[model samples]
Target: MSVRHDWYQSESKVVITVLLKNATEKNYAVKIGPKQIHMTADGYELTLSLLHPIVVERSSHKAFPSKVEITLAKETGERWQSLEQKPILVAPTIQTKNWDRLLNEEEKAEEKDAKGEEALNQLFKKIYSSSSPEVQKAMNKSFSESGGTVLSTNWSEVSKEKVTVKPPEGTEFREWEK
Candidate 1:
């Protein structure tokens, strides 16, 4: 569905009101994340990567006959001038020969999997060095169990030691460690 959003911000919260002209209250699904949003209205998809992250658990939405309003609690007490990373985002109406034809089931599944993995990796890498001893041990154990591969990792402040994972020269690793 072709849509536009009006964003409002306060010191502690941000609200987004999306106008979907031909949409109804019962025909849309919205997914909110820390720094992302995904919605499907009558099989039309709209996705956004937010400029600033918010408290995902505190976000909620309300649907009107022709619009949806989303409220997000900011992670900090700061006002924001913009909500999305892009300035001119036009919510494109998904193409469909029939109502359900525009649904991207496969792409949605792949994106969910990729986002989950990426978020986990980012969280681990961000706090690995500063984490408590128990957390560190847990992460290491988890990684070891999964055989996760990081080609090269440098803990610069932790003595500049680099851990490298290299397969034999002639080997071509093509599959994920499942």
Candidate 2:
């Protein structure tokens, strides 16, 4: 048994017309250089010289059907370049439903935190409002014993006894809590 492979070489020429944004139409004598060519969009005239040794001719014609004609020069001679096609790999798409569910859970968590903070503020206000002068003094004493400071609005007022707390050595402490 014998295996046989068939391949064909093909060449093509195309005439492209580019209209400038400034209302001027310029004809480019473009020779398809290599597998790709770069062109500017503005009205400025350009010469495709990157793939040099390949000659290109430019002319103005009134009777011609196309504005620009690009033809491979005879010096290039019927050289056939192989075209390779590679399979493109695409990433797996994420489901819209899963994304929406995750966003909804995050929004709910934020709402719960906001509600908890509001409740804490209300409880602090209630505790401060219901306490009287003697109760406030006792509470301030206890707070000082726990290594915290209590400030009073009245500058003329004085506390009879001062309380201080000293933590035992080798005890781990959080400075932020103070």
Which candidate should be chosen as best, given lDDT against the real structure? 1
Residue 44 lDDT in candidate 1: 73
Residue 44, model 2: Cα distance from true site in angstroms: 50
> Per-residue lDDT of 62-94 in model 1, one digit per residue for the tens?
887777888989999866757778767687997
Candidate 2: segments with Cα more than 4 A from true spot: 1-83, 98-100, 133-178
The worst-scoring run of ten residues by lDDT in candidate 2 lies at 1-10
| Inter-residue clash pairs, candidate 1 | none
* Model 1 per-residue lDDT at 86: 73
Model 2 lDDT per residue over 55-153, tens place: 344212121333232333322444444322233578799655787888899999999999998998687567757877665666666565546544332
Candidate 2 residue pairs in clash (backbone atoms < 3 Å): none
